[model samples]
Target: MLRVLTVALVVTALVSPPAAGQPPRPQAVTSLLAGMTLEQKVGQLFVTYVNGQRADEEHPDNVRDFGVATPAEIVAKYRPGGVIYFDNDLHDNIDSPRQIAGLSRGLQRASKIPLAISTDQEMGLVTRIGPPVTQFPGNMALGAGRSTTDAEQAATITARELRALGVNQDFAPDADVNSNPANPVIGVRSYSGDPKLAAEFTAAQVRGYQQRFLTWSGVAATAKHFPGHGDTATDSHTSLPVVDRTVEQWREMDAPPFRAAIAAGVDSIMTAHILMPRIDPSGEPATLSKPVIDLLRGELGYDGVVITDALDMAGVRQKHPDARIPVLALKAGVDQLLMPPKLGEAITAVVDAVKSGELTERRIDQSVLRVLRMKFLRGILTSPPVDPDKADAAVGTPENLAAARTITDRTTTAVRNDGGVLPRRPKAALVTGWGENSTRTLAKLLGGKALPTGATPTPEQITGAVEAAGAADLVVVLTSGLSGSPEQQALVDRLVATGRPVVGVAVRNPYDVAYTSVPVWLATYSYGAGALESVAKVITGEIGPKGLLPVAVPGPTPYPLGHGLTW
Candidate 1:
């Protein structure tokens, strides 16, 4: 039985290993480290950002206002092992993949070692790469569709596109189980509430990236926010979430997907900023807890790179001195320090820690060796820098878009169609929640009035919308985060009270259905233009709905997990 295997995994995870098994360092990596200074070795542990725009240019609205550094400047001074790309880097010129490739190449050329060019391209809502890159449905949709092959295909395309754009590391396929429907951050980013299904999907996604090479140079996939960010209701971006599960409960519910990811030979596991009190009684988040990280390495036997989540997150930042958090994380067994608040301060702190006997040089070498070994294995050490001329042609091709469409089409699920009110090209009114109308394809499809009822609509607004939509054949309420927003629930309740047939479209969160009694309901796990358009097509019977429900909706007669209907 699956439970037996899961139990065995937990038992193994609980027993700490004597030491993390270090992979054989490549000769180049060995020679490079042998000749490196302590500061250079410490620099190899950081993966910071680079500005695509001019250093003199004002910080873009989307980018963090952290101290800016040119890729070349970072290499010369900070000597970071890697550089992470963000929307600010390419949002201005996303259509030009060659330019992105040029950025990656320039950064690599400036580095002493081949930098691990990385991004947070989790495909759907979390994608760092902008439009034209295939925006496939996210993890919740993949879980709803119940197809491992589709999940693998999506990830492969993601890897293919990212590698084409000269990014080799993708912090994606969020392995968290969405056990708590109200979880603020992990909501639809997670695959399923069921650990077994999430684990299978996680493994499939890992295989997609690791097994399928976009370039001969390949890509590395990271299974992220480890020890599960699912059960907690807090967002680690703003505060530290305490996961109160006992060790056994975590092994059963939270650890399976990670175990499966490790089994699939994942390239990296990013630590969560959340604290697991049961796993380690010491009042420390997993990011700085030796017992927790040791459990992952010693018991789980994950020898691959152990990356930390963004250090700028409040969960860790508010807990430690800004300059010292990176050092503590490195001491806690993190190999890659991602997005520290101050790049120079973090590198300097680590160097000072070593000199002050707070951290040993041997300990630093252990992490640096692991980092070097990964770079070597990924072929970044020997592979030529990404060719700018070939990047645009390879990335965002029609073939890749078609693959993304195929995945999206299969993932749009119909959760409810009471009295068969769907699959009709009805005169429908479009009512939206926050950021719901990035594309007006749904409104354009219905040839109806577009109304913003607000994220939490006023009763007057809802009633007015109901009156406004009186002439329409159907009322389509596009709701987001309704499960957590009572005001949104009131808006949906009033709309459903209208005489017209009401179709509840859970725009971003599938659990939005639990808040309303709409005659018909549908769930689009992503707010991407393609995903929104796919929902419109599925509703109009242009395409059939194939996705199953990845999470349960609470009610007296609740829609169970995997409950999906097709006309």
Candidate 2:
């Protein structure tokens, strides 16, 4: 029976609900905005991007030059009320999942209304579709495994593999609160530095991406970069990152996970080109600020759908240029402008600013009636087409890689073992200041020997990994920032001066255990092969390291902010 109602709606989105549900009736968005017009309600406030599925043939996974327009000329001339996908439209013609469900059923069969097709899956390491799906273990390893039912079963298996590839929006649970452990783009895509434990794992990843298909047709989650790119060290995807705190230290650390992702009913939030300037001293960067979208709709009451974040970043493209960032992100109230970098000069500068009154066709029909009321509360206007052969049985389903290896074996963290040097099985030698398939998967999970160093390692590859760590018995470095290079702290000081039991592992910044003085340290906050197979089954003990330090690693171990140990 449709596989027992998709297994009782994936076991009711794997438990963990408790609150926030309401939000869907706007009377089919007031009778579809009383039959739209003004250039189709300014193309329903644009959620643009095509990543080319044949636009005069330029494939190689398209996103970088938008292949000059083809999915029937972006659905017959920018009728984009939504469409996001990337990684060049599912690897330019062959990323499977039935060729991205026939390129999202040919852009919702050349849209007129049913569109909102988004992606940026946010599976560890910001995956934008490419793989047999299910990657999980993101948001600082679910805030180092303080699981909210493993962040609502990894956003209900990444919203049931983005609804079998027709992708009904998921920018994702990055409700940023990494709280600057030198945040250059929300470390471990944040789930903590404790703002009520990143607002209880951002309301358990917005009830695992908007209540995992409660009775069907779902997805839309978002809650991103808003009001806080987690205490920025600048990288609003190239430049503007300021956040100088103060609305009571940003309501005690970046607005409590965007007020628990708008009380967990998050159908979309996004914003944040970072520049709080103490909550808008008119420095303008909360995507062009009207006191930061009126403090997310009059002091965080957030009536959903704000979006912004990628108006071709350089923090709002080095201060607005390609026809003033979609009419100053819809005069800073922003319902959605997402990837706008001259999508026909931002829809002819919002239809020449509503024919020169500088904006106001009833403010573009109140942001295209909040983007057609979140595509009619995510049913994507009565969903149907996009069964490109049930996307190979709804992508990577072994019940979604056993719910992405049970949330990457509960987020791997053993923060500094010190002497017991981690469930030892050694004969190992796997060093990597750069990933060669994470030095051949932690050297075939420790039957070891794979030294590949290049993320700046040459003093004869750090004296050949200090003479292959003097014929290994134990020496596994794997890093992605040990102090981001002096040849990765001269290859972790020549593999901890070859006093062999050295461990290290930080694979993609858990602040590289504050520049390694390693006696043993681990943190698979993402390099993703299911977080390096849960850091090789927590160093061969076959998983037994319930991860903890969800941010705070400054020089010296005592790792703080929820550090982990567990033998």
Candidate 3:
């Protein structure tokens, strides 16, 4: 039955809608677009970042940028269509569910049109909202489990929590195929290396996010970094990375998940910052390239809201100044300018472009209508405010956490189990690893001593861990990003030399197994609480490893994509 469903989905994805047959615009959206002024219409094209948890609180960044100290004032002055939240040390928009709910209600109160509140709640390493929001081991883990049902359930839980907090849109389900192991930005964020697998999981997640969960409406799902960011070695946040895949190669390797997303009727598609010179020789990144955007619209028939990936990033700003990026993105058929560096400059530039005949108000209307249609379709206009008092009851419930744990349990893959080293009880176990929290959790779960290593461990630390390994019958070393870290690999190698029956666990990227040789190798894909618990259960024979390899591990003896071992 699952095989039949998978085949049906892939078949549907391959068949694109005719170019001339577009979906009819909602009359409410049309009316809303007609009533809006030029400034308001231009404002609808932008989704900016603002600081503070409350709408009324004074923030330095808001004060300097918008000349407004509060979120409400900024919203009133700029009239942006949406707002995105980030949780960092300097400025945090997420604290607790009730706090976030209050912030969402306050923002809605200030806006004439309801705002599409969004965040990058992609759940593994890229998670923005923390506990008591249920954290699943991310997309790669879902791929490892090879269960479309689990994938949809994870997204369903994510959407439910976000809606309770009054966040209407989610920038998630990274559609990039992680074909390149050296990729810095999108490693485990991607579902699988195989295009078909990635497409299936991407489609399932899109459906999960858009489907109504319980009492709350669905949050808008975004299939991100189109056409694909999987094969790039560079991080677009710092600089522009170019993918050199020919048009045919891109169609086969990079375009499947995006096609699946469009077929599933994803609410939005976020453009990548990297340059695909093969597609558009003009050297513009996909975020600001007409040919690239046309491929999504003209070829894929994705007429939904097209958003840029953070215009403030160095990738988009490399060719043009900060002010010109919004206009170029709009000109390239991008509907929403996400996180522009200077919001005021971006708005002024768009307004000036319209007045100077560089861009038509109709062009602005085209994007605005799309954004308004999304808001209306997603029920953002009718139900903007959420109950702050009931948010705690909805988010991170025991049922949600249990579901997350079950999914993570299914994702623990035993890649190498030499001599049946796993599913055994060791007299004394030593837990030593790069992640402090993960190592500590594993140590506690195993009732063993933990010697945590930094991301880059010193010789003395390695020696100390080795010396500690001698006292235990079993040693488990947690590795992360080992493909690039020789020192961490050396640490694992040195532990194996101790003849202590070492087991290497990849808590981040599964590619760590390729960099080292260990008698027993297991991959959890994420070091989150649920994943850590799952790994512990697999090690102690409480549960067998049920996960398959989502991506191939290249080493002296390469493991194929579907490789997994069970007791």
Candidate 4:
């Protein structure tokens, strides 16, 4: 038998019944659920991806995958409850904010019910939308700032831009604690290594994302990779990773941020594609493990929409076929199956499961009701078509950009300044390292020459950077993935050997400092334009170093969490 949500939990946890004039009437949700067919109900359980920017445009990938040439045709045929936008090779669903708003309107026009448009706009490395969208340095940057108000402000700006673009759902505020130094996937994506700090930032971001704006109901904030994807050395995108934390360890390390998110009334929680032997020995990933989900539903009391990570990933596909994955996830108490490998097959399998009595229609109704209630609560059902013309005005305004710069400025962490090399204005400087764009930007800002190198620098590139450093009084080297790349570490060592004052700026991972012996070390946590500009200002003594280290860097002498040097 499928586990059903208790009425009290449904009322309190799932629906979050409004105070006065808020929406999602229980009767209206019931009426809508009563009208959906089994196929329609099953369709509501999957959030699929489309290939084109415009709903009416003919795209070859859409034709090949869905037997339809246009997004509108796919929506009409499949009637998916939601669609996620991605800018990958298969799907180029974003161009400009105005274009996205128009596409969203067309897709909603094609569907019988309004669609919940979503994207992974978690800022920093994972931000899907770019440019005219205000770019804030991501979560770890926020973690370094250690200001809950800044975290909320960043989320509020992001929510405004996303809502203006007609996207209503954000897979954001990662909420994972980066306890393991070698975690492959979630490095700077997490807020902090300390659970309590991560928890505080998570709750603040939730409130920011869900706060209603003028004429716009709030965007639905999702606290993701539930149970926790941090503390693992492997990446889930390639294969399943096992986290061996016992129940007590998990509660102490991984559960605090999720718990804080729940108390902050996050609209949804996304399950990770990881297996924990201590939590569930059934060999199923958390996305398909009922026992693991019980920890969220039973122990944590989260009855909100439980969404699975992308179904096409290798983590959840182990030993399970494409069709059976969706069925197992639904049985495991997941409300939404995200980005299934084969959308039609996944939907049909669930419908067939209901027909064969393996899954009941009542169980299907429960999830659909939860989804419908969220759609109603977020004003997706009642809101008018997004105005494409006003999208540019709403997104990336001057005020919002200034706010983003302020937040990024506060996150420039000075991990080490042995000779007080930072906050020094150098007449002649050489800027070189990983991240070509970031190096060029910093060089332009600092009035220095830029010799940009790749993440894994070639020997020739290292020699060229070393030659360039000889002509300058100071050298600024940007490093990324230094822990794994000895060549990049070698480049930093060579630049330091030049006998010039060398400042190593880690633009991606702050842990790069642990692998280098540079006299001066700083972490921007991001290579975005705003972050690089902030780093330049700190180098020139325009601003003091204020950011604390969000994660511990291990070495012969370790830099513990919350360590930073201020001048």
Candidate 5:
């Protein structure tokens, strides 16, 4: 049987609701709070991660980094209502999508309550699937376009792939509308600068993509950064950033996409750790803010589940250094306390809080009820049947991968070019220390040698590389903008200053291209194997540049959005 534990537990309650010839199975669901033991109800609100497996460890999957127990043991021990999967949690045996399905079924079987398995496979940003997988540029890349069709398409494929592997819920299609490119963390993770466009795209993504499980009976979608976390410049992993926007400004800028997502029936909302004094003056994170949670539940009319960002993030850690957060989060209306790093302690803390009247049992029961209701609606309690192989039509097939390649290819941008920089007259070339891409491999493909430099190249590196060309042919610099680091800008400026025919290509975010005046440049939005191969083919002049500037490049923002300049 293709059984996941959460569904199994739910099915245990549902299997005998009516006769086999039932007209419609009644929509009766257990109030996980109503009929369950206190311990079981409290367990319903906690989510743990289990990437490692050991015999004696206390916490499951060692989300606390203690490596105490394996993922299976964690589920069996705590019976958490949800589980979060990091890249490390994947079993190595999952070479194809099918194997991943089997592994997921096995994990789900270990749980007693219906478990919602969530993975942060943001489609293109940090995919853990195998080769032949098409890479969609992260949310930022898709945001540059006029329509959200691309994002919807990419999300559809993502849902299909994940569902094939038995992943029920995905924390993706980030609804954060980022207005600033200088945002150190959420730059590439977001969709766009325009709030309305981001909302429209996110709506399409959730509506079009969230239908995967509904349409295919397997995958479900969750839109994230609820109550808005994209506009702030600070990284939530470090400290809680105070979004200085007033309520009116927030409604205008940051609230649209989330509203759109809610309209689209998103299964869950992940709270941001950032502080919004305007929304909650207590200086607590949105995760532990009753005002903010109330805003989502009441004002926004959100009737779905509410989950907190990882309790281990510094945003929560700094405020409560004692690891007693899951209790406070429950009191604040959070349904799931994700990856607390201290499961038993977190559970005990909640129990203690209820005992002392610091946290009420009724409050915890509210979230538990919501969780159980959802499972009941999905028919997991009585009928926990899954066809892990059925998603084969959607996941990893050539059709889906081809679509991934098409969008990825569309994002490769040309940031700059002065005096017709392409089609170099001479054949000589000097390539070195561009970015962390396969520049040398491409150079070799074009029958040239790639060299390593002793000192990090200065404006002199490009000049030296160009000058060393000695009128040979072309000097191409490949640089990667992992986080759009300043060192990246320095490298490009040095290369462009060389006054050679510099074609600087950013293998990440297109916004990183505006910093340099490189005579020629491109942004290939992703660094996957397919992305690298495509960029390499373009560099060797084997293929004409078919990509357009997905976003506005500095200076010669020559091509308008989606403009493809043909030679």
Candidate 6:
């Protein structure tokens, strides 16, 4: 039985239709398009969430009935016009899920501009797309793709899944230049530390998502962590992360991929919450900076929508609580504000800023026009009302899973299998797995007793696992990182010296494999189960291996790029 199952994609050809060759912009924008006051345009600049539980406070009757995004009522009373998605689970079922999309449709029925809903769903692990759905590796995995083609496959598969789910905006393909290994929050989510490779793959991912243009009905692709999220040790979720890389370093390392993505016609750009005093010197996060947005909009020539990361994050609310971030973000030229249900409060803030001459109606209009443009391009502005019920058969179909597996097959690279560690033609083989998700996938694929080797392996544990495998004449190690910490490196070294043709799989960032000379080095690039199953197929000879290292596998020494085997 194949551990990796391919499911056909079920396209909801009806709900939200694509605007092919949409004549630049559709004249058929929503009737909501009909209600326009200059103040509403400025108000539409901020997109906040409505906590359903808070609905009762704003309208007591809302709880008794479907008031439509009750949490939004507090702010909707003010009328800021955009909405964003976070970790909120919109449904209880995976195959047939009833999502907040329904609620969103309900709210848009009342908004000024068609509300744009967004999520940080770069890959399956980063989202709540329901179960039995295939997930690809994160940006780290895509960066590890043996070639630009690999990244494209990963991107294409990812795009298909999101489109099927009725999500119009994906805050994916992290463009941040992550040179620092210690960087938290963005480790496996980034493409590469090398700007050139990152740029190439970023473009690849764009193509992947774009290929499904018709299927997505104009889904917006967002390349984020702009100005770079890598090189910072701090996580913005806890407090504001400060990037110390000077403007010069950013120009060379951090800016290329994002520039590439924008040029590729990405529909939107997301602002990072980090502060780089080097760039602004004023101590403001990129989401609230005139300089940052100006650089992205003016210098980069990104004319599409500009959105902020979740405003509810600690980085924005804690650091600059009283500053009116949503208002400043728009004045700074961001087209959409994310996740502030206190839409009324945010609108009042923006209204004050404009009245005080701190912001102009023109500035607000610039953003509103862009928001309208996207909805127009998406065929949602002037299109028919999308009944959420029409979406039932469209989410997570077999065809979509096949697309994901196809991408995994294309992207998963088998760099080395010297000594025939693979095609373990022998009756049985011992396999050791790694990471929470990957370990599970490998076990399912290999179909035998497998042991967990942890992130970094201990010499004793590795030796023990290898010895156990030696009994079967082959030892396969699937690892993202070595475990057993300070004393564990020696154990891995000993396992290699066994001359058992140990097969090693790196989950992402082939950097860790540089130090050891494991005869077989496979870089899968992510924690997705789909990638793991692909790797198992490579070893079991179910599929021929063709992936090469897209990035250098750094260790004490780095493996040259294009390092992989041909079947």
What is the C-alpha lDDT profile of model 2 across 1-567, one tens digit per residue? 243234234333433432346654444355456766788778777777665554343444333444443664565577777877677523343367787788787777667567888877777778777577767777888888887988887787678768777888888888878877878777888888778898888888788777743324458888887777887887878888787887788878888888887877787888888788867887778888887788779988887688887777788777557678789878888878877766767777788888999898987887777776676566676566678788878878787788778878888898877778778667555555577777877687667788788678879888988887888887777878667577877788778877778778887768788664777888888876777777777776776898888777777544678878877
Ranking by TM-score: 4, 3, 1, 5, 6, 2
lDDT of 1 by residue, 83-142 (tens): 887775333423367778877777766666668888888876787777667778889988
Tell me how far the alpha carbon of residue 82 in candidate 6 is from the true structure, in angstroms, after superposition: 3.2
Give per-residue CA lDDT, model 6, range 1-567, as digits (tens).
011010001112212554553324322233333456756766667665444422232444333332443644533554555555444543122223345446555555555445565556678346545444446666766655546775676566555445444456667777876677666677667776778888887877776765533343446678887777877888888889888777677888888998898767777788888888978988888888888888888888888888888787877775555438787778677888876534456667877887888888767766776776665454444444445675655545687667667766766677765666577644555667466456656766776556676766666676677677666555666654443243335545566787766777777555556645577777777656677778788877888776666555555656676676756
In order, the Cα lDDT scores of the candidates are 0.77, 0.75, 0.87, 0.87, 0.64, 0.64
Tens-place lDDT digits, model 3, residues 320-394: 889999989889989999988889899999999999999999899888888876775566765635889999999
Q: 1-567 in candidate 5: lDDT tens per residue?
A: 333444455545553544432212223344334567778888888777665322222443255443344566767778788776655533222355554555566566676665776677775555656554445667766664344778778777776566566666777778887665556567567776667777887887776556532144434566778778877878888877778778788888888888988887676788888888887788888888898888788888887778888888888776774457887777787787887867788887888888899877777777776776555433334344345576455566788778876776555555455787764433666665544346666466556556533224455554555456555466666665523455445655665666667666666666655554666766666655566655555666545566554444433333455554434
TM-score of each: 0.90, 0.36, 0.95, 0.95, 0.83, 0.80
Q: Which stretches of candidate 5 lie over 4 Å from their true place?
A: 1-27, 31-34, 53-68, 88-99, 130-134, 212-218, 376-395, 423-434, 438-472, 480-490, 497-499, 533-567
Residue-level lDDT tens digits of model 4 in 51-138: 9999899999998889989999998999998999998878999999889999988888888777889999999989999989999889
Worst 10-residue lDDT window, candidate 5: 20-29
TM-score of 3: 0.95
Model 4 worst lDDT run, 10 consecutive residues: 1-10
What does the lDDT read for residue 300 in candidate 5? Answer: 83
Q: Candidate 2, which ten residues in sequence have the lowest lDDT sum?
A: 3-12
